[model samples]
Each structure stands twice: as C-alpha cells, then as structure tokens.
Target: MNTPAALTLEAPAEHPFAPFVRILGKGKRGARNLTREEAREAMGMLLEDKVEDTQLGAFLMLLRHKEESAEEMAGFTEAVRERLTAPAIQVDIDWPTYAGKKRHLPWYLLAAKCLAQNGVRIFMHGGGAHTAGRLYSEQLLDALAIPLCRNWQSVNEALDTGNLAFMPLQDWAPHLQSMIDLRNTLGLRSPIHSLARILNPLGARCGLQSIFHPGYQSVHREASSLLGDNSIVIKGDGGEVEINPDTLSHLYGTTAGVGWDEEWPALSARRHVKPASLQPEHLLALWRAEVEDSYPQLALLSTMALALRGLGTPREQAFEQAQRFWDNRDTSI
Candidate 1:
C-alpha cells in the first residue's frame, strides 16, 4: 500500500471513452472502441484510486462481457509497466512465468523446477490465499521446499544459482498487489489481473508471457507483436506457460528474429496423462515414481522445460530433463 497517494487519475482531453462507459453502465452489449490511450487514462484512475467502486465494478463487468481488446491490454500493460519496479539482474536467461491460472500440486512445481534446475530461471507469481479453498501455487512450492523470496535482490540470487524463485505478489509490486483484496470486496476480476500477467519484468533480457485461455492467448500474442522485440507468448495448460497436453504448443516469438515455430518440432511427444489420487502423500509419491521413469510430473513441467529449451529437444527430452532434476533433487534451494 503506497499510503493512498493523492488522487491523480484523469481521462485525457477529448477522450472518447465516456460513451463506452455510459453505454456499458446502461447494460448495452456492443463493442466499444476504447483506444489504447483512453484505456491508459482508466488505468491512471485505477492507479490513483480515483475511480469509484460503483464505476469500478461496472467497468469490470462490462469489460468481462465485452471482452478485452489487444489495444486495451497493451495500454493497461503500459500503465502496469509504469507501476512495476525493475528486476535486479539483467540476464539473457528467459524463464516462463505462470500466473493467474489453476495449478495442480507437485505437478506444476515439478515442471517449473525442471527448467529452473537446468539454469533456465523459473519465475511464478500469484495472489489469493489457500484459506479460501484447495491447493494454491504457493502451497505447492512450499511442499517442495522452494523459498518464497522477499525482494527483487533475492530473486536474482535464486536465479543465479539455477534454482526456482518464488515470491509473494505484494513484496515486489504493492501498488498492484494491493488490488487482490479488491477481488474479495468486489467479487470481480478487474483489468489489473490481466495487466499483471503480461507486464511482469522478470527475465529482463527476454520477457515471456504465458497465455492460458483461448481468449488471452491471442491477447498475449497481439501484445507481443506491438512490443517490438524481446517478448514471448505461448498457449499452455490452464493458462500456464508450460505445455500440459503433450500436443503442439503454439509459441509466438520473433524477438531476436527467433520464431516460435523454432520449437515446434521439438515439442512432439506423448501426452502425460494426469495422475489421480486424493491423498497429497499418495499424489507426491506417484509424482516421484514418474520421475524415476524419466517422465514429466504433469503438463507444467514439460511445458516449462520445452519453453526453456526453445527447440532443444522433443517433449520427451524436456520431460527427461525435468525427471533428471527431480531424481537428483536438491530438496534445499
């Protein structure tokens, strides 16, 4: 919390979003052409806490109903960039981050760790506590003994050592993390969630964005198209950046002139069927067994491995990398 800074949000002069907001508040359901600049003004309002809760709720509902545009996503992302603090170390090591999606236990952790252990730096971010319901990314990371770091400096240290880096959302970006509480108060997901995913500053050398849903997949791709270079967008498990189904994962990256298809041929392999078990211990033991056979823990591991390799090998090879790491497991990171 930045001490509730003085309200500074104001729509730009001659902005055309007024009509969109009015039409949306009235329950009209057509496309509202809010230019990228106009949306920036809205983000300004949100950042400044100038937007009223009533209008905020309506804005979220309308955006959800009308869906988001690539331009809007880009604009909001720009606003988020203005809000985010830079990562500590600037390295060419690009790691995929899985934020804002459902995660399975040991499965997701195993996958992230697979690439992480091999020097590809893994970064995962999320909010909302497990006190609400079942498993969360935080809990899974905890079970694996991954330390939840407190600052950007700690993240660099973790990455430098070829270990997974986990951080609670609030420590790095309180301006944005503070909004997670709003989801509880408003019972709606605001644009902050979307912007947070794409605007992360990790892997400063090569920024990567993971697309989970059919809708946001395109959103991430289009956003990258505008970013010029050093950005990646890929569709994977439940919005994770990791491949889940062992099917072809469409990766879009022309940064440094390296195409996404560069990794396509390498992804071919059998889909690792998601193992089922109620007991946590039972599920983890099963995961370890899969590791013994050199199989991937789940979709996340395979996806993270391949994304890190970017055509290093087929999905099986990537799975093997994950398996090797797990087998030689350093329970301490």
Candidate 2:
C-alpha cells in the first residue's frame, strides 16, 4: 500500500539569490558583509532582474540596517559600470544630483552652468523626484532651458553644443532607478542611493558627491579610492553638491588613489536664514543680474571653487577663477 518511489515529488531547490540574503541576514554571530566578488555577483543578479521582490526587499533592508561598507559600495558600483554603455562623450566632471533642494534654490545649477559656459564640460545626472517636498533638478530643466537627455546620443549632442547635460537615472539604469523609487515603500533610503552617486558612467575625470549624513563622507572617499576614481565628497547644503556659503564645510576627496581631507571656511561673516520657499524663476533672474543677492552669489562661487579644485586647480586660484567665470557668464537667458 505504499506509494511508488517513482511518483514521489521532490522539494524545489532553494532560490539562487537566497544565499546572498542569508549571508547578510544570518544571526549576529554568523552574519557578515559580503565579499567584493560576492557583492558583485549579487548586484549582477539584481541588475539582471533575476532576483525576486521579497529577496530584493530583504537584501536592501539588511544592508541598510548594517550600513554599506566601502568594499560593498565599490563592488556595487563596479556592477553598475559594467552594464553602462557609456558614450564617447568627454566630460570633465561627473556631478551626481540625487538629493533635491528644500530650503534654497538650486544654486548649484547656475554654478554648473557657469562652469559649462567657460568650457568645462559637465555631466550631471539624478534620480527624479522620489521624496516629497523637495525641488529636484529634473523638475526645473525647462525653466533653465537645460536639455534633459534620455539616451546617449542626445547626451552627446547636448554636451557638444552646451558643455552641460543632465540625464535622469531611469534613462541610463532603469533597474537602479526602480530601486530608488522604493524609498517610500521601504521607509528608508537604500544603498543604491549612495551607489548611484559614484557611478560616473561616462568615466569623467572627476566625480562630485554630497551626503546629508555625517559619517558617509569617509565612506564615499574610501569607496572612490578603492575604485581608483578621483572624487570629492562633501556634506553640502541640503545634501546636494552645493556648498552652503554661510557655514563652514568639510571636503573629503580622493586623488590618484589617495585620500585627503580639507576644511573650507565659511564665506560669509554671518549666518543666513533659510528661505521660506523655493522659486525656480529666481535662478535665471539671478544669473541675468536682474536681482542682486549676496548669498546666492557666494553660494555659486564656493560651489564652483570646489569643482575647480577637483579639476586640479589650486584652492586660492580656483576661487579666483570661479569669480572670473561668474562675472563673465553669458547672461543672455
């Protein structure tokens, strides 16, 4: 009366991605960060969409809880770079703008514009507005007349004509963009937020990043060094890569595979209060000299100085050059 052995059903084998989650989620004693190679493979699976939603959620949350190490970030960034079909565009600076502005206008955009107008080819990219109550760069593209490119061809053309181009993350890496969109559902920002900052998809010579959290500056500096990328990480205004001129800021940078730190003193003698509301029109008006504001001018100058320093200019000389660039900007807008 026993069932036939041939008719017996075997259990399904474990999911291929289960091991990665288990490696991170194992009990405290057994859990450990994934090795570089393991992280690469795990991220590869995620990019390829071979991972299930449950596994993806668990993996991201586990990494978030533990916080990602430089090794993990390097591995993740490597996986992303492998998938990017970067065009032959020669970009001087890789500016990643994932964080939106809340308290002030995006003064960094004008700084980038000034840099671009002066022939410094800037490549800026960001994830669209995922968090609420903030004004993202993507939202102000039309107002500023900056081209929003969705493909490498458009990016190439834009850079060729204007020296500055902004590409949204969804256009270049849809998988990672999808993960970023999960911020609301997950109730926290995932490692992808940090990973996207260092992608430097076009292999630009310099990468600029800003982090809101305190300890992440070192994490970004070390990770960029591990990847052999020349990068500058700062705790800028509202977490975007724009320096707050009213307060002192620290710059954590890596060059030629070595890490260095410098403290940039405040540009203003007194602190300025945050604006009650943001206005996009003011960016162009300020650039056109239709309105005079000391805070925004200093903000632009300081931000451009940091970028010039990234491009191998001396600190004092960079500030001088930034001033010249601002004064000579083409204000025909």
lDDT of 2 by residue, 59-80 (tens): 9999999999898999999998
Model 2, residue 94: C-alpha shift (Å): 0.4
lDDT tens digits by residue: candidate 1, 195-296: 666665663455556666575666666765565435566765555455555566666664543445434432336645454632345345544553342233
Reference-based lDDT, each prediction: 0.59, 0.92
- Give me the runs in candidate 2 sitting further than 4 Å from their true place: 1-9
| Candidate 1 off by > 4 Å | 1-20, 23-31, 91-103, 130-134, 161-163, 184-188, 254-301, 310-333
Choose the strongest candidate by lDDT.
Answer: 2
* Global lDDT of model 1: 0.59
Q: How many backbone clashes does every candidate have?
A: 3, 0
Clash pairs, candidate 2, are none
